[model samples]
Target: MSPTHFISIPVASPGITENLRKFQDLCGEKIHPHKVQYPSKLHLTIGVLKLFSDEEVQQACNCLSEFSAKIPPILCEQPLHGTLKNLRVMRGDNQFVKVMYSEFILSDDSDRLQNLADKCLEFFVERGFMEYQYNTTAVKLHCTLINTRWNNAGPRTINASEILSDEFELQIFGNCVLDRIDLNEMRADKSFVAENDKRYLNVSCVSFK
Candidate 1:
């Protein structure tokens, strides 16, 4: 496959972007953390559609358009720091200087958002599109962290005492609407670097609120 397409919500924040770039640079040059390259804009994936013919893509778009209209936009928060099993590294400042993945913070009253995701999956399934399966937790969210490797490293644990005792704020928020879906075709067989183009349907967003 050359490219692939999916429904996703991109995370854009200066704090995250700056640290992510630095982490990638360090991994690539000094630390030599095996194959830790920078990432494209981080995103929360809602769905993934297999490559389809042009006509099928058009149909998918129409369906997604209707789907978008039926749902109101969702707003959510970002994670500060959490523990995974084995990945991520901490630096001198006791900050999450290097991490493979970031968790999302969910609002307690997120039933509305969860309902929308459920309805979207039902809509796709009704249309013979069985590729829509959401996470089961009430959290009902996803995030773009680091790659799965770095088995030697475990969930990053920083020495909070060593660095600024005060908590560092590193969170971003955005309104996610079910905008247009893409019809990407993957050339590279690799899941990470599958080359593809995206024709993003109009997306509206609001920054930290």
Candidate 2:
């Protein structure tokens, strides 16, 4: 798959970003420096897509608008509030993990968040804009914190011993409040412009609030 774009909830809250930096500092000696995510690049992804042309990108933009318009007034008027309270391994395999992420604990109704994710995924997939491997019935919200892929050195997996220590077990990454969904560029381009220090190319964004 070309995998050009993805839908994501941007995380730029001041308290959250500051705490993320603190979390990274605590992890500095263990994980490779390249593997840590920049605070500006932090986000909770909804779905990935493969759009190959301008028309396709614009169509995806249209779909975002349509999806945003249909939301209920109660859910749409305010931000989707949540917290980053725990760290998790991808697929629960801590021995050989390519990704370590912070769990998103929604303070708002969990089912409402699930339904929103399901409906959003359904909207894009049914229209042939995106095909998500994320289960449509239950989508777990998470923001990736460490990725081994960025490390150019030998093995690209972090072992159990290399995982975060017990001190981080009850550690809170930060609180997240998101209202907008962006169809943004997944592949990084050096020539792209940055919006408020965000490096990704944003084709379109629709605010639920």
Candidate 3:
């Protein structure tokens, strides 16, 4: 399986970078615990393919080339929500990102989101990867800024969603960079124990989308 392999997408936007800067100012010293420490570049995930042989990898890459030719990149804008209004930024089973981003401010465009995810999944399946499905409702397209341990730690003074008078402005929607895809290995020590050691491929970002 080529040791470990995956397909990944890159995500970085000016709006997002600005928001990260704001978060650093607002969050102060508490932001260092983040995996990236600070907000790194970001990207939307398209498909997840497993590792394969040289011929198989070439075949998969060919499939991706065809896919990119067919589907262009997508530019989108999503409203931002902080921990105050999102879900209190707690740490526990699948509760941090999903409970907040899923239910906060996104539109109920499950059908459309799922359709996109399914397209990615189908491509992987054709590449001989296993079939997996995530509900559009559960699909998180958000670029997170803070993820605090929800144990006995003290609460944050300000939440990302509540940065302004009422709501936080986390403008992440931008050009869909479909220029390339990357292969990343999944770490065994992820937040979710079950997802450890899982590997997949994803689309990086392109020049225009």
Provide TM-scores for the models: 0.50, 0.86, 0.49
Tell me the whole-model lDDT of each prediction, alpha carbons only.
0.42, 0.74, 0.40
Q: For residues 1-209, what per-residue lDDT tens digits would candidate 1 score against the true structure? A: 42245545454445554655554453343233333433334554555566457676666666666676555453233222221111223223434344333534333434544454566666665776435444442223455444324334543332323222233232232323322223233222243553222223322221222
- For model 2, the superposed segments whose C-alpha errors exceed 4 Å read 73-76, 134-137, 153-155, 160-165, 189-198
- Candidate 2: tens digits of C-alpha lDDT, residues 1-209: 66889988787677777787787676656677568777777887878888888898888999999998766653655567888767778775677878888876778655566667778888888999777674434456788888888668646877744445675533786776877788898866456455325357778998776
The per-residue C-alpha lDDT of model 1 at residue 3 equals 27
lDDT of 3 at 133: 41
Each model's total of backbone clashes: 13, 0, 25
The order of the candidates by lDDT, greatest first, is 2, 1, 3
Top candidate by lDDT? 2
Q: Which ten residues in a row have the lowest lDDT in candidate 1?
A: 79-88
Compared with the true structure, model 3 gives a TM-score of: 0.49
TM-score sort, best first: 2, 1, 3
lDDT of 3 by residue, 14-72 (tens): 55445546655654553343322232334334444565567666666666566654344
lDDT head-to-head 1 vs 2, winner: 2
